[model samples]
Target: MASFNEDGLKKKLDDLNMSQQSIQTVSLWLIHHKKHAHAVVNVWYRELISATDSRKLTFMYLANDVIQNSKKKGPEYNREFGSKLGKVFDHLGGLRLDDKSIKGLNRLLTVWEERSVFDADQIRSFNKNFNKDHSKEKSKKRDHSKYESKSKRHKKDVEEFEEIASEPRVRRESELTEHSPQDSTPPSDPPEPEQLIEALQELESAATSDAVVREKIASLPDEVSDVTLLNNLQDLNAARALSQKVEEALAMLEVYNKRLAEEMEARKSVARMLHDYIAYQKDLLAQAEETLEEHRQKQGKVKKVREELKAHLQNLPDISKLPNIRTGGLAPLPSAGDLFT
Candidate 1:
């Protein structure tokens, strides 16, 4: 495990790649140190601000992974990232992003919205900041269109052009053809070995690790639960004191219950992530093995062809040993009259 320090985290951010595995790996690390989530988010934002344009989206993906995955564990990461994401979006909106990058960010926003990762207002704010330039461009285009005037023929042509542009492209013959299951399915991108190890290790000490809370819940005083005992109370003051003790006990139980619920949810979330991760890795491994078999079959065919070609070559008379046709080494001439006789 890397040190839970700003410098170490910065180094990790510096090496981050725009792959799911990379994003998940870093996310797991952040979640593992979620006690320091506030500090982690601060470093993440600072690094994101300073990172290159190409690396910025990757940072956003990392943040999204952490926020979504760690939310069940606790609200620390969610709160920290929620506070900073608006500014991050503001920074991103200022850059000249490509269509792909824009779509990627939009997809993340959609996921966040669909998952209810943030409240409606926060998601709306993020969308506004992220799409500021796009919204402005659309507004400008609308304003421009209002002032434009054209001949009837030109207007018809423009309308036709717009219609054609809006229509979906026809698929090519090859693209329309049926594909095998393997071809239809996208390739899997499994996480690094180290990442899987770390994730498994983190799961070993999951939210259920708090035995103290469990102990406290188990050791509640009997007076709090035994209402029959209240019948024996001799005075109103004693009964009131008993009531106070009962109230305190109830309060403690309520707090512990909430904690337990959170822990249970966190455990379930980790289990889900692990299951998906493991399934993906297994699928990838199977695919790789299938590919390896295919390559081996191809190699065997190539080797057989080479051996056949070698045998055929060896069976042929050597050119050097054969008589040179140009030297006329054999007697071949016969006259027509000699043949008749």
Candidate 2:
């Protein structure tokens, strides 16, 4: 029986391998673009499957083999590799294009991130290419006036600076002996975006720029045109907000748990006290009944007529004091077992 089960298991494993190979073949065909093929596969499996299975499973096995084989072929075969592969998928999936043709292509190429088959260097290279290509394409679309405008702005700035230098300087009282205020001095020019940008660019281009100046310019906040910079700031802010919210939630949960623990302890204490009180009452009742039995044993039974007559004479006054015979002739007495029962 065990041999039969083992044989069946081996056959199943073989079938799974065949299925996985078939899937990979279809996947490669579906993924028409070689640039993002590996990335799509990695992301589709990585984020979508459990880690242990990812490494051992036959389906992922074929996908992993394909990526490794592609990497060996050439640098051009490198897609967004590694964990970052998932991010590429995330970016593409977020696009709002509802066109059937575009959507179908996206669906066909859809894959999640898989960490097992990741290659970091390949991803870096991919990003470098993507950025270079994107920048080139954007430059091609822009007008020549954009570059010309920069040169014109620089010329105007130099002229303005020369004009300012030609004007007389305004001197304070401390330097009155050497110079005096000149009304001819042109009004100080207010700073503009173009001026700041030009200054920063010049500093950046210089071979021997001041470290402090470069740091200050680089660290200065960006404008709308620098989407990456703005996005980084927004992401930072969002992370901070999420962290604060998580901390607040954890604090509230801690307080609730503490209150619950205190309530549970109080209830336990009350239960213990009630249990002890009931046991003490039972002990006291038992002692009282034992004492009553001892007194009866010491008295013994009445024997003679004279003793009975004497007892009757002794009880005559008490019996004659009854209120009404019909209403109070007999008050029911409980048996010995009634006390505990």
User: In terms of lDDT, which candidate is strongest?
Assistant: 1
- Give the lowest summed-lDDT range of ten residues in model 2: 182-191
lDDT value for candidate 2?
0.40
TM-score list, all predictions: 0.43, 0.18
Q: Residue 120 of candidate 2: its Cα lDDT?
A: 53
lDDT of 1 by residue, 1-341 (tens): 33467866786788788655566556766776788998998888998898888677678777777776666568998999999999999889888765445656787787778768899999999998989887765456557754245233345533432322222122243532343223433222233457667766765555456677667767877777987777788999988998898887789778767766876665544444455456555644664576589889999999999999999999998988877778997678899988999
lDDT of 2 by residue, 1-341 (tens): 01113332223233333243343332332222345555454444543343333222233333343444444334433344444434543443333322221222222222211232334554444344334334443465365555556455445433432322222222343543232222222211122335444544544434233455445445543342254544454677775865575565556556555655665454433333334333334433564476578666665543356688898898777755776758866776788899779
**What root-mean-square deviation over C-alphas does model 1 reach?**
16.8
Clashes of 2: 8
lDDT of each: 0.69, 0.40
